[model samples]
Target: MNTPSVELADQVARAARYLRPHIQRSALEGKRELPTPCADFDVHRLSEHLLGSLVAGARAAAKEPLPADAPTTLTEPPWVVFPPLLDSLAAAWAEPGAWKGEALFAGSVRPASFAGTITIMELTVHGWDLATAAGRTFTTDDDVIATATAVAAQIAEGARARGIFGPEAEPAPDAAPLERLLALTGRKSL
Candidate 1:
């Protein structure tokens, strides 16, 4: 086990906090199929991806072997299960080993820091997606938003090329922090 970066783990935990309630709100509102800013994913599919990513993050944090066929969609209601899954992801990332080793993601071995960075992006960006689709407001701490924005900018081009994200939407001159983050992820404020 290798020592982890406390700041990175803190970001993951904070993002989990930011995302949790919106998921519950979306589920309670029964807006699973509504279109999200992601374009390709409805609220349900995006929630499924969030849940799956949390599971993978926890497993990777512990340095456990990843499943070759992890499910991308949830059979259970996301709101019912996602809170705990998000909690576990935060807990796993908090561990010392999670920051120092390589982790498997999308069938590739990536630096553990890379995995952690994307996990933050997943929670914040998709969290915003779910909230928007459900017609709810989303917000997060400044530091959390800052880290997410940096991660988004770092991976935006590659993510776009892989079709995971759409082409970047231009933001207004005075776009807010969250809006800027969303734009980098190819989302426009709804």
Candidate 2:
């Protein structure tokens, strides 16, 4: 973390609003079996993962113990909790010590700032997954994309070799910021 000019928490909130439309639409469509760009997740399953990720992020930011992984989707629709869940993540990170030192991640320790970056990337990348599944466009502010791009590159430096992400496809040098962000994360083709 180079100490971004725009706070990571702020960008997380804005990215949610930008992606909210697509998420709402996909949920409303009720096409649980529809395929998304994320190969392993279908609409319903991805929605469940989205909900879990939201919960995980908020907990991580608050320095709370992360809930154990579950094989369940949310029993009720997530619309009610989704917004506040994202807001909670942002709110927690806005606190003074949220990004300092280390945070717990699924029973292990990780750098808080790096975990925060992963939180943002989850929303940006998976938000795109939801959008693409719903046949919607995925566009957010350049600030969000730029921060995400930088963060993804940093994470990929270590994780790419572990197959945490597929080999990244290059994007054109002049491509839109979001496109580059996606490309660097193994989500877009040049």
Candidate 3:
């Protein structure tokens, strides 16, 4: 049987393939403002943040030293950064053995594998953010959604206990597993 981490990685790859084309064609209006689920970020900033996270995760998975000037704040569009970032992510995931159970950086509380899961969550949610900001819609494969749904259900259980979601935000009555996944992660739609 596949480990949950491996399964989540596969789901993430599927979501990334589904998202890559849309990300490439997305018109990232540099100066124009657009809202995002991440409170401090507008569209451009969020894209940059996503790319930065991807880069970090990829590097960590490779067991490489992080760049000295790694971005601390969001700055660029995903379109400009995703190609290399995605390549790194693919390489990291394709590597043999388990890196997820390893520690992330010097002082992370969670294992590197959990960090990978968070990266997957970030990609899925940010893909939704990009599409929403661009006035477009995107969908994931059902298999990916099923896996994501399982992950999201676990997250939602913890988030609910911690009161992380807002009162106005509720999972739709008949939301698909992916939709619920997104909703649990603070994205309104799938």
Candidate 4:
């Protein structure tokens, strides 16, 4: 029987697959610029970052070497790049004996358990970012949103301490928990 954590990882894998096609349809070509929630990135660059991050996470998950062909220059349109990368990631995560129980990055280390949770949160939030950048909208499944919110709340303390929420912004009283969570993380929606 699969562990609950593995089950959740599988769910995330499925969602990533579902998101791939929509992400590929996003307008990320020349001359048509779209805005992104990330202050420093336009839509295309944000997508590239997301893809790079996904590749990094996949490498961590599988304990595999980073692909030699991975794009070092982060300028490729996400629609042109992410599908194959994400597909490879999904496959890597799905393989038996692939998901290591621990990962090391730079001078830090983390459990694969937490890594999967973080992946879920990253994909959900970045999915929202992609949709916003494209001037489109997409809804995450309730379970995924709840999971992301929980993960976000857990990480918010550190992020908040680092002034991620900005100095003068109080949490919105009327916002839903998820909305508050996103707002606290500096994402105010599309």
Top model by TM-score, which number?
A: 1
Off by over 4 Å in 4: 1-3, 30-32, 65-72, 96-100, 105-107, 161-181
Worst 10 residues of 2 by lDDT: 69-78
- Candidates in order have lDDT scores of 0.81, 0.73, 0.63, 0.64
Clashing pairs in 4: none
TM-score for model 3? 0.76
Clashes of 4: 0
TM-score (all chains, Cα) for each model:
0.91, 0.85, 0.76, 0.77
Candidate 4 lDDT for residue 60: 69
Better of 2 and 3 by TM-score: 2
Better of 2 and 4 by TM-score: 2
Which stretches of candidate 1 lie above 4 Å from their native place?
Answer: 1-4, 25-28
Relative to the true structure, candidate 2 reaches a TM of: 0.85
Pitting candidate 2 against candidate 4, the one with the higher lDDT is 2
lDDT of 4 by residue, 146-174 (tens): 76767677777775686533322356678
- Candidate 1 structure quality by residue, lDDT tens digits, 3-48: 2389889989999998888877534467877888877788787777
On lDDT, who's better, 2 or 3? 2
| Predicted candidate 2 versus true structure: per-residue lDDT over 4-116, tens digit per residue | 52477687778777767766644546767878876567877888888877777777778888656632476766565476777777788777778778888645799877777
